[model samples]
Target: MRYIFFFFFVLLTLSGCNKHEEPSSNLIVSSFKLPPKNESAASSDAKDEMAAPASPEIPQKIIKEASLRFETDNLEDTFNRIQSAVTLNKATIQNDSEGKDYNNIYRNLTIRVPSQNFDAFINAISKGVSYFERKDISSQNVTEQYIDLTSRLNTKRKLEERYLQILQKATKISEILEIEKQISTIREEIEAKQGQLKYLESRVSESTVTIEFYKTIAQKEGVKTSYGSKIWAAIQSGFYSLSEFLISIISVWPFIIVFCIFAYFIRKRFKRKKK
Candidate 1:
């Protein structure tokens, strides 16, 4: 009877161990609940369940931009207004250049503004242009990019915090060095993200004003080329050709000398044979 009782107890213990053992890839999103405050062991079990994952949860956010193109007649005034609007919007100018086309001088301007004032600033800029040659406007939806950056930023921040915590709690010198290295990488990533955000803000604030100045065609008086100038050009060309010929002769002198020597030796050999 005692043997039977011992065997049953062993079987029960084996079954309990199997129940407690979790799978290698357990993805538990929600927290496990405890029975009661008195069940401290159960609460500890729930806490252990939460702390099993090696990686921290990353939060996602989407970053996007809107592009605008406008043409204007009042180049000077429009440029001034654009600069002012950029200042007011707390943004910066990214690019400002003149377009290539002699007949029509076009100014291409890029401004970075805040996301909130995107539509308003665009509308304000549109009002300034005399004639809208071509207005091409579109939104670059960076949903994935934003989400990825947010996730990475969140992860890095968490890592930095954890490293800081480790720096305080760490006892070993090796562990402290490792934590510091991680902190450095995280800080770099944070700074890079900040720069990216700043750049985006500057671009969004000011609308691109490609001011093309169209000049009316006037009858151009043609000046005849002077006889002396034509003569000088011809002389210069002749001098260049003469120099090129001299350079070519100088370059092939070694080959020419070798050929001459060979011919002389053949002539001497033939004379000696005839004699």
Candidate 2:
């Protein structure tokens, strides 16, 4: 009876100790253990969701340009008309040139107008001219390119934000340096994308038109004949030709003198040999 009681007491004591120790081991593990793989994965997924932001919706992007060439009776008058048309259409003359070549006068103009007024401005120009030598209209669709740039910009911005966050949390110097480098690269890319987007937007909003017009001087009929003027012109031409010939001779005077001296010596030597 004594042995049985001792065995029962020992077994109970061992069981109680095991139970108490099990809880302690569990507490230790819970305090010091890292998070599970699934939990870490979930956190990363959540961060990604926060980093990637949505982009705004933009409509079609189109760049329009035109070229026009025409002839006019009076170039100066046509130029003034073109300037007035540009002003009336609320456009700007980006470039302009006017010059006379021989008896013909020509003017060239490059204008920029709002996309909305492009067609109206073109019509006004056409109305001012009598006939067109060349007329060309061109359109470039940049919608896809614009959208692609926007997407890339958004992605780079998100990446930069992520790197900033990581930089803040980084404890090691090496880790911070790497994160900063990545952030700088992402920032530069973002700025480049922004510049491209702005340029594209500007091109899409404004339209370009080029105009070239010219006039030729007309010859007058029934002019009185002038024999005296023709005779004077002939005399002047003859004098000019004589002057040019004299100048050519003067330019080679040194060479001519040397040749003459050489010829005299050679003739003297030949005469002495004959004697």
Candidate 3:
């Protein structure tokens, strides 16, 4: 009976010790444990409101661009008109090129205007324009891409923060080095995302316009040629042809001599056979 009571007491003591020890270790692990994945996802935008835009419907990101090519009577006048429109709309001229092709005089311009004034600037430039030789206008939607990048950047930042927290608690040099490497990688990724976001914002804010204006030269009426002038031109053409033929013959003089000699010998042989 005593032995049975002793065994029961010993088992109880060991169970109590285990319960106490397990809880302490579990608490330490839980303290260092990361938050639940669901929580992390839900709080994606909580840390940074810029991750997602406030309004769901408004403020869509759109990039606009246009290309215009047309014929103009006067290049200077067309350039001046575009300049006036650019000034009126607070637009900027990025590039200006002027050159002539065949019988056409052309001027090309690249302009950047605010998104709000995209259509207004186009209309302003179209005042005296009758037709467009080539006109291309396009718009791209980047709302989803912006949102995606913003969200990803925010998430990476949060992860970096977590790693930093763990770094603070880290005691080993190896652990510190590894965590810092991860932080560095995350920072690079963050910078890349930031660059992408800025590019998108720039495109969405300003619209690009390319204008090409050209003038065609009309053909002049041909003058009547006098009879004497026609005779002189014909004589010159014949002289030039004769000179070219002589030059060609001179170039192959050795071959021509050989062919003539062979022909003479064959003629002599034929005459002797006939006799």
Instruction: Identify the runs in model 1 with alpha carbons over 4 angstroms from their true place.
Output: 1-133, 201-209, 219-275
Which TM-score value belongs to model 1?
0.42
After superposition of all CA atoms, the RMSD between model 2 and the true structure is 9.6
Q: Write the per-residue lDDT of candidate 3 for residues 109-202, one digit (tens) a residue.
A: 9999999999999999888899998889999999999888877878788878878898999999999999999899989999999999999999
TM-score between model 2 and native: 0.64
| C-alpha local distance difference test of each model | 0.63, 0.83, 0.88
What would the per-residue lDDT of candidate 1 be over residues 88-139, giving only the tens digit for each residue?
A: 7676677778654644546766666666666677667667666555566555
RMSD vs true structure, all candidates: 15.3, 9.6, 9.2
Q: How many residue pairs clash per model?
A: 8, 0, 0
Q: Is candidate 1 or candidate 2 better by TM-score?
A: 2
